[model samples]
Target: MSSAWGNQVERWRAGINAWVTSETDTTATIRVEAVWQSVAWGYNVSNGVSAFCDCDGSDTPYVGTGGVYASKGETRTISMYTRDFTVPKTGNDRDVRCGAGVRLAGGYHDGTSRAYCSVRISHRTWYQPRRPASFAAKRSSDTSQSLTWAGDYTGLDGGYPWSGVYVDRGRDGATPSNLATLGWAATNYSDNSTEAGHRYDYRLYSYGPGGTSQATDTLTLYTTPIACALLEAYKPTATTVGLRATGAPAYVDSWEFQASTDGGATWADAAFDEDWVCADPPKGTVRFRVRALKSSGGSSPVTLHGAWAESNDVATLCAPLAPNVSAPGVVATGTAVTVTWQDNHPDGTAQSAAQVEVTAANGTVTTADVKGAATSWTRAASQQASAGTIRFRVRTKGDHADWGEWSSYAVVRVAVAPRAAITSPAASQVLDALPLAVAWEVTDATGVSQQSLSIADASGAVVWSATPGKGVRSLSVGTEAGFTNKSSYTLTYSMRAGSGLTLTKTVAFSTDWAQPVTPTVTPTVGDGYTLEILIEAAQTEPAAVSFDVVRVNPDGSKTTLVSGLKGGQTAYDSLPPLNVAYSYEIHAYAASGAVLNYVMPYLLDSDGHEVLSFGSAAQEHLALRYDAQGSESGKASGETFHFALGTGQDPLPAFYADGDIDVTGSHSYVIADADEYRAARRKLRAHADGWFRDAWGNVAVVAYSYQISYDAKQYMQWQLQLDVTETMWEEPNRG
Candidate 1:
């Protein structure tokens, strides 16, 4: 069996078949089968069968350990021991080709022999698709998560065709399971089954026909909670604003809000209160936005803002302006009062109701309401009590807001009362005439409805009564019997007000109807134009009486000649003006200084004269002149007419025959004193050539003469004689 100089040389052929069974990224496994065919059997020793491969395109020893030996023509086939060989990089083909052959070394050797059979068996290696990298996830919706990764890497799948990708999902750190399979073209996936406000884990694998690859790193993400949308913003009160929103997922624990006053140009954080209310906002238009929050202080992103809502005018929610009372400050007891207020609602809201509260000094309280835009309320007269201070306040309500604050209190004083009093004819007064002047005064603030006057005797018997007109403060009422002389009487005045209040007053008075008796008065001129006045025969009625004499001067001024003089003791002397006529007033008074009677007398001065003339001779005679009368009471005497001069002169009987002396003149006078008598005599001498007219037939006065006579008790008297002639025949007309 040995050849080669000292070795055995045997002819043998080995058939071998080799194929790959498994492979990895670094190594490959192969299986081989061979049979030994001995050409000649000689010196058969232990020659074994082995395999060889061109792992790197070169003939090299096959990596194997065991070998087999067989007899010539035995026809034995032994399986090669399992062996692994390192594989090289397979580029885009994902395949490594190797040249392989089997040999029976140590027992047979033939370099050029065609062995029994040499076969080429193909070996295939395992291939895997690329695994994705850079995995990421984000919220796609309120209930879903979105996933993404880089494209599949080349040179790693061993030239395998990509089929699809596998997406796995898990919740709260749990192990992930296959959630979906997507084609290789899909770079993103949506986890639609995710719940709102939940944490999820996600991974992805790029797979081909080879198999699925390793998963991406587990990703943890949270689905967005339902978004909070702002519904409205409005003022709930004057100082507070409210924000209303809708939408909240099960995981949402709270809400956040922001407000803007400049139409969303800027925003301020608003306090998150229950019902989304904010306090003490600016008084004007405002805008609001809201978002949901989690218990961990995580909230929706600021970029995801809700709709802005505009608030109502802040004034609209304010209480109505303070009310005002328009009632009078001072009122009568039963006067009605009306209260009013202004509807100063900033939004001009319609008035819906009003309330009024009233407190009286007597501790009485009253409240009332008016509905339907009524701003005023009236308290009836029946509700007003007399003699107290009344305080009242009011409040108003609008249709859109709550009732306003109460107004400041208004005070009213009710103190007026009906009053009646006798003004004239005072207490213990004495009246002197019938229809005694009885005057009274009455007053009532509410207004007088009725008034009356009455007079009664001392026994309270009503004797006279009269109804007085409205606004009549005084009335005169008394009959002759009611006002009896020296009688005591009572006067009563009664008044009633519109509110049924009445009052009466009584006064006591007496009547003194009897007056002092009238007195006789005589006045005479004394020496030097002095006046003398005497009063007598007076006052038989009144037990006590006095007389007063007043000299009325020409200038209308009075000089008291005598005041408070007894009836028989009234004699007065006064110097009189020479030519001015004056008068005197005499009054009779009772004991109480009341004027019982008065008289005014006109007195003549010395210059006062009468004219008597005969023919063309006219003379201004003294006041002693009068018509001739046969019966003289010693006041005046007669005057005769002569055709010639006085006794010292010669009578002209031949010139003035009996028929020539047809008329005679006679005149008389009483001189108050010697000065008067002298004055009269001087006047007669001044007109000594006077001719006078007589009451008899035609008489002519050629000369006149006067004589004075003095009386012991009466004034002096004077007589004058004149001769006068009648031009007309008055005797025939008289007959």
Candidate 2:
């Protein structure tokens, strides 16, 4: 078990960390982790999780309950106590500790998960029993008296029953006797040493290993001269019940009557006579008793001796009231309806059968017998009232022989079947959230009791539902969050009229949210240098979305190149150059400012060719941004830039084609800079800036355009002289 289940065993070890006080002293609460192995679980089977304690450790278990197993991965902490662990016949104080004990946690294979550990009771804790009850001594014979009693409780012993009862007794005028011990099961004992005229009392106690409990009721027992009593009561008149008693010691004369109206706690002397008349007998059940009283008329110390006989029980027999039929308050005909009513009796305590009498619109009365006191009854579809007025009344038969009177008639009206329509979310309606409202024209003399509106998915699963209140023609659903967009739903509104007929109308719709088309940013012009950022989509349904255009500059700052265009507008020359490789971003946002989609517009560059563009670092444009501080008049823009090749081949002294073919300057055009003019010039290949005309002999200007700003912002200052070609050298007066 250790090698195969090392991780699980370690987890169990960590969970069953140490013994805890169950927050209580006597019982030990062992904490065990809820993890278990499921290898023994059969195919498509799961195991129940529980913890058991084998106090005897003999493969026998005790009772326990564990937490619910939601799934395999989740677990809960289980605290097993001595009660959850102990087996029968195990001594709690001694057997709570483990030598032959084990804790079994069953969330594994066939519930065989187990951990062996010792549980020691720190010290002998005491469990005291409650005070004993019903300690009484009754006369058994002329020479003996018997005692009977009950002790307080058990269940703390863990595995064994509480045993041994302590009894103490004393004579009426003497000191108490020594304590007498009786076995746990012995509830009665006979003291055979009692004399006929003496009185004695007994006190009871329960003793355990801890200590004896406090005294229970100490009742006095005696043998009176009159050993037997018989009391007879009879109703003499409508309101009078007289009681008579016969007792032993027959020679006593002049009997005085004593009566106890309250079941013989205290007696009233002659306040009630054998034939006293009462205006009203008590309504419910009452108890009465009669005590035999005797008095001597002689003057030699008159005495009265009397004793009470066991009481008699009686009740006034009255029939139950009518049963109220409470449901289908607005019944709809032509359908089966279950009639329900509140229990006329408390908690369904009706003692007799009930009957429901139904009078149909045709004046035909039918009485239905209800077997027991079920308050509600169902009328089959065949029994539903077809037209006119039908009424119902109910009666109940109680514990007595006779049945009660019928209840007052509950008038029910029957009318035509209900008609309804789903007015809102009309047919084929497309909406983000499915809001439903239903209208009904159910013209019943009696109004509708319940009406509901629900939206069901295409699979007929109810997605939303609601019950409308009274006088409401329309009911709506769909105020909850998180709606499924790309699906169809059926909105059904149903109204049940007064005659139990339900009318329904359904409307089917689709909530398919067509995603916005991906707009393109393209280079529109046929130049190799510039790109046009355009945004558009192929929309089937017209949507309102504001366009946002952003240009990412070289240093990772964003410029709002263009924005707030609903559609169909263009900004010319707003884009930067192609060689700078800027990234243009376009987004379509709804009125809520929630972005619908990012627009990666097609890049249509100057060459009339679609090009893939990139940001500044890699310079993969086919697009660019010319937004940095510099002379902005296309100052650095040119057809081709030139730099000298190989020191210009000794400066081409005579300019012969064959003499310095290698000295011809190399030409390329890619000087896109973000710096000022002078700093920008330092970045170019080493060369002189004065330009000669091309071989075509057109005098091209290489003049500089200047830019100045207060701090860093630069604007163009354009100036050029197209006639100049090169520096003139002074020819020693030969010009």
lDDT of 2 by residue, 1-735 (tens): 111121233223212222433524434444322223322222222234344433334454433444332234434333433333422223444423232122335433232344444444443355666555676665555476677766555654642235678778777546556457887677777777765434566778877765677777666555433422765655554344555556633434334444445555655554454353223344334445543333322112234444545436444345655666664555555766565554343112244687888887788999988887567777787766575667888877655566776788877665566656556677988765334444555555557878877778878888777777857776545434123556787877777666666677788776645444555445465332334555654453435366767666545566565667655555333334333334656665444222444534232233321122222221222221232211112122123434365654554333213321111222222224434333333422232333222221122223222222232333342111112122332111110
Give the Å error, residue 181, model 2. 31
**Whole-model alpha-carbon lDDT for candidate 2:** 0.48
Score candidate 2 by TM-score against the native: 0.30
lDDT of 2 at 57: 47
As a whole number from 0 to 100, the lDDT of residue 626 in candidate 1 is 44
Off by over 4 Å in 1: 1-13, 17-25, 29-35, 38-112, 116-131, 135-203, 208-238, 248-275, 282-302, 309-393, 396-735
lDDT of 1 by residue, 56-131 (tens): 3445664443544557556444444333345544433344343434544554363322222222323334467778
Clash tally, candidates in order? 25, 21
